[model samples]
Target: MELHVVSHPLVDHKLTVLRDKNTPSATFRELVTEIVMLEAYEATRDILVEDKPIETPVAPMVGKQLAAPRPIIVPILRAGLGMLDGMAKMIPTAEVGFLGMKRDEETLNIITYANRLPDNLSGRHVFLVDPMLATGGTMIDAIHYLAERGAREITCIDILAAPEGLKRLEQEVDPSINFKVVVAAVDDHLNEKAYIVPGLGDAGDRLYGVVD
Candidate 1:
């Protein structure tokens, strides 16, 4: 349960635009992509790689490439879908997966409505993408599902996180999960209704213009 706050200037710049209520959906979408790319850069610092010998016109040299057992990227849908393009721009060869989840309005519980992932993620480096980690329900359920499939090394990437959510994840989940949470900003608190206070509202709605 390690935490990595991306403090780069470019990340901050992108976040400022994204947090604006006036930013159009088109621009907001692009900014989210850029920010995710920056955060993914940090989250994937320890990605496994192997050396391979290669010959160039100038000289022969050895370089590093992704190790066997290709990495997997799972984005919690619908808002998570907005981040897919950004992530794919970096790891084009990685396998893509999707997990559809929603938070129950009344009980604030996470509900998994759909999942489309390979059977065995064993020995795979998985990156879980979700724009907002306000209450931690969706992320908790997501990690549990991935773990059930044999994914041991996992990283959760988000644009924003609430303190309550981050605390709950650390206290409730085991540290050995090899989980690293990379976010641009950790907000102050969660509202009684489980929404992040002064946080970006309804990531799915903002990203896709859906009310439900």
Candidate 2:
């Protein structure tokens, strides 16, 4: 399990606004979107590409294009939905999938209610987008879910993560699984309720203003 804590100035700036408890719902949502887009830049660093040479206005130039079997972007539903547009804006040719995972509040265990990804994902690169990685249950399940379907590579992107969650994932999850995480900031720990301490808080709620 590899981890990347994005240190870009732009990401930090946006994250600062996001961490502010006083940030309103509208502004928080927008900031989260921006931070995800920035993190996606690092998350997709190794995305498959094919080199192509073309004649430019000045001279011949070489470039690369997304390789065949374009990467698939799977946003674990609800909070993950907020990251889709930001990722798509960067990788327009990438295929999009959906995974709806719910965590049992009492047990803090994850349950997959829905998945619409390709059945034969062999040799396909998959990026799982979830705003917060608090306990790692959803992401752990998400990676295994895609791997079960033959995904070649998997990367998890989040705006914030908890150290306890990251460590638990490293120790408990299978080492044979080639996985990496790209996040804006890794917080100190998880509260009793399993929320990242001083985290943006209920990313879905902040984004959509819906309470249950």
Candidate 3:
């Protein structure tokens, strides 16, 4: 698995605000969109494109276009939903899918409660979006789920990640699979309770309110 941490002034500035506990949900949602859009720019650097001949006002020329077999954007439920709009803005033509997963706080295991995706993803390029990568269980399982359905390549986009989680991903996931992770920042570590230290608290709660 390859990891790319976006480094830009705008990304840094927005992230600081995002980390503030005082930021309101409305602002949090907006910043999430903006940051994701910026991250998407870097994340899609190697996106498949093909040359097509088109006539401009002056002359005919070849320009690049996204290749066929449209890429699919799959957002892990709840917190992941906050990133959908930004990714969609970046790749409007791409298809959208959903995977509902959560980490069992007690067992620290991933539970896949829902899935709505293509039955045969034989050659699809999938972009999995989620706000955080805390322990990596949810992501590891999500990747396996996509791989099982025949996805050829998968890119995970997150706002923040912990070293523990990233390491877990490296040690646990299949090396043969084409996988990559793009995030705004990699925080210090996961605390005893499994929360990322000095990291933005529960992204879902920040974006939407706390749920009972």
TM-score for all predictions? 0.97, 0.95, 0.98
Question: What is the Å distance of residue 11 in model 2 from its true position?
Answer: 1.5
TM-score of 3: 0.98
Among all windows of ten consecutive residues in candidate 3, which has the lowest summed lDDT? 103-112
Model 3 segments beyond 4 Å from truth? none
Native-referenced Cα lDDT, model 1: 0.89
lDDT of 2 by residue, 1-212 (tens): 99999999898888988888799988887787788788888998988899999998999989988898889999998889988888888888999999999899999989899989888999999999999999889888888888888888999999999998798789876777778999999998899999899887888888887776
Error of 3 at 204 (Å): 0.7
lDDT of 1 by residue, 93-187 (tens): 89999999988899898889988999899999999999999989889888878987989698999999999899889887765577889998998
Kindly list the per-residue Cα lDDT of model 3 for residues 1-212, writing each as its tens digit: 89999999999999999999999999999999999999999889988999999999999999999987889999999899999999999999999999999988899888899999999998888999999999999999999999989998899999999999999999999988899999999999999889998899999999989999
Cα RMSD to the true fold for all candidates: 1.0, 1.3, 0.8
Clashes of each: 0, 0, 0
lDDT of 2: 0.88
Better of 1 and 2 by TM-score: 1
> Model 1 segments beyond 4 Å from truth?
none
